[model samples]
Target: MTARPILLAAALLLGACSDAPSPHDLSEEAEYFEVSDNSNNTVPVAISLRPIKLDLEIPRHHLASIAHPYKPWAKTIWDRVNLQVLLPDFQFRNTQNLAEFNSQDSADVLRYRIGGLSSDQSFVLLSVNKEYQEVDDFADVHLRAYVNRRKYGNQSEESIQARQPTMFVVNESYLRTPSEKPIVLSCNLRRCNASMVIPASNWPEADRVDFGGTQGVRIEFNYDQKYLRQWQQIHNFVLATIASYIHYPESVL
Candidate 1:
C-alpha cells in the first residue's frame, strides 16, 4: 500500500510539471529582416514573441558602447512594442472617450524599434485613420486635464509643490502648424521638457506626436530634454527613417 501511494504521488507531480507553461517555441514563426539606412548602417531586425518574462543577458559586443558600463542586461523597453498592428479592439477615436471607441471595429498599423548605443533609443510609430484635427483636440483636452489634476487635485500641497517646476505649459510660438499644436514646454532648474507630446518627464522624456495630414502616424519616443526645441526635425527624421525599414504588405506609411 505504501509503495502504491508513493507511485501515485510521483505521477501527480510529473503531470503538474507537464501542464506548466513552457517557452512557446516561436523561432520558426519569427520574421527576419536587415534594416539598412541610406548611409549603409545596418542592424538585424526580428519580430518574434517575447522569449521570457525576465531580463535577457546583453552580449559583450553591445556592452562596449556604454559610457559607464555595469552589469548589463536587457528587458522589454515597451510592452506595446510587440503589437505589430493595432486591431479594432485597441483603436481609440479619442482617448478621452475610451468606452465608445472600444465598441467600434477598426484597425491601425504600428511599427517600433530599439536602437542607438547599447539599445538606449527606441520609438513606436502608429498609423491611424483619424485626422490631424482630432489628434490635436485629443492632446489639448488631455493637457488641460493633466494640468488641472496637478493644480487642484486631492494630492498633498507638498507633493504638488515638488512637481510644479517640471509641470508642462503650452508654448505659444510653436503652435503654428496643426502638427505643432500638441507641443508643450516645461522647465525645472536642471532641464526643460520641450516636446510636442504629452506626459512629460525629466531625463528621457516619453514624447509623442500625431504626424498629421495624409499619413496620420502617431510617433512616440524617448529622448533627452535638451532636444526639445528640435522636436519637429526629430519627428520628420524618425518617420522617414522607420519608413525605410518597413516593406510592402507591412508598411505603416
Candidate 2:
C-alpha cells in the first residue's frame, strides 16, 4: 500500500481514459479505399480535355500537296463527341444497368455509392522502327478497374494472391474516339481485356486506382461469384452503347 499501489491506481485511470476500438473496427470488415470521393454528396465527375498537341515533323511540301484532313478537326470532334454525347450516354446506360443488377442481387455485390464517370485524352508514346509507318493519330488509353472486398480473415499470402480481385478493362472499341470510320491503325496498344478473375476480389492496396484524371466510369461492386458474374452484363451494356455511337457516326459527330 505504498508507491506501488499509487502507481497502479494512476495507470488504471489512464487506461480507462484511452479510447477503445469499436466492435465493428475489430471485426473482419472490408476497407473502402476510395477511387472517387463523393463530393458534397454529388457524384464525382472528372473530365480532362487537355489540348491535343501533335509533335510531328511532316514536311511543309507534303502537308501542302497531300490532302490530309485538317488535324484540328480530329481533336475537335474527339473532344466534342466524347464529352457532349458519348460520355453521358455511357454514364446513363451504366448507371441503369448497375441499379438493375444490384437491386436483384441478394448478396449486395456492389459498392459504388460515390458514383461518377471520367474521360481523358493523352498521347501514348510507342517505339517502332521508322519504317513501320503506323498512323499514330488516335490516342491510346488503357483502362484498368478494381474494387475492394473483405477476405475471410486470416488469409495466407499465397491464398490472397490466388484469390486476388479481378481488375476489369473496358473493351477496346470504346477507347476509339469518333475518328475516321475505317481506322487506319489500331488506336489501342493492346486489345481491351477484362481480368480473368471476374469481379476481382481481395486486392491489395497497391492495386487501388487513382480516380484523379481517370477517364471512364468506375463501378465498385461486391466480390461474390454470383454477383460478380453480372459485371459482364454491365460491360456488354456499355459496349453496346459505345457501338451505337460508333455505328451511327452522324449521331455522335
Candidate 3:
C-alpha cells in the first residue's frame, strides 16, 4: 500500500521512517553491472556501480496468534520467538537490524538479487490493524500468540531471513469496536496460521495498545492455506461455543 489517506492519526507516525538510503552512500568500488533504464547514471558509470541494491530496515512489531490457545504453545512461542520475531524490546539482536541497513555516508540502498528470477519477487506491505480486529471469545479456548517482530529487539541476522511474512491477523470482530456481526475467519487458504491462547490478566492493562487501545501497529503475519482453513474451523467453533462474546456479523471484509 502507498500509505496515503491514512484515516487514523496514529498511522501517521509511520511516515517518519525513511524509505531507503541516499545515492552517495552507494558502493564506490569498481564493479561491472548493467544499469536499469530508470537510473540517471550513464550506461558505463551506472554499470561501474551496478546492481542498484537497496538495504531496508523493516521496523519490528508483534502479532497475536489466533489458532492455538494452549499452554506449551503459548509459553514456547513467548520465549523462543525472540530468536526470530521482533518485540518492543530495546536491544535488536545487538541493534543489528538497524545497523546492517546503512543510510549514512557509505551505503545507500538494498535490492535482493535472486539467483534465478522466475518472477522478480513481489511483496505486500500491509497495515497491521486495517484488515482485522480482536475480541473476547471464550469458545474452544482458542490459541492466540503474538508475532512480536515489530518490537525493538527481535530482528534476524543479516544473512538469515524470514521464511514468511512477519505479521498475522484474524477476524473475531472486523470492526475497531465490538459489534454483533459475524467476523470472517477466512484467510488465503494454503498458508500457516498458528494460534495461541493469551490470558486477559497477562495483558498490560495499563497500556491500551497492548490490549488494542491506542498503539498503532505495523506488521503482517502470513499463513498458508492449510493453516488458514484450520483457523476457519477454530474460529467457527469458538463462535458457536461462546455465542455471548463473539458476534458473527454477516458482512464481508
Which candidate leads in TM-score?
A: 1
Cα lDDT of model 2 by residue, 1-253, tens digit = 0111000000111122134444333323222211122332233222221222111221111111111111131122112111101111223213234443335432332222111322322222322232122221222333322322334679775664443323333334654323211111111222222211111112223322422233332222223333333444534443343333232112122
Tell me the tens digit of each residue's lDDT in model 3 across 221-240.
23233343244543443223
Off by over 4 Å in 2: 1-155, 168-237, 242-249
Residue 233 of model 3 has an lDDT of 44
Comparing 1 and 3 by TM-score, which wins?
Answer: 1
Candidate no. 3 TM-score: 0.20
Residue 248: error of model 2 in Å?
A: 9.9
Q: How many backbone clashes does candidate 2 have?
A: 9
lDDT score, candidate 3, position 202? 26
> Per-residue alpha-carbon lDDT of model 1 for 98-211, expressed as tens digits?
343233331132222322111111112222222111112223322311221234557796765444323333333533212333344333443333322111111122111111
For each of the candidates, the C-alpha root-mean-square deviation to the true structure, in angstroms, is 22.6, 24.6, 23.6
Q: CA lDDT of each candidate?
A: 0.27, 0.25, 0.24
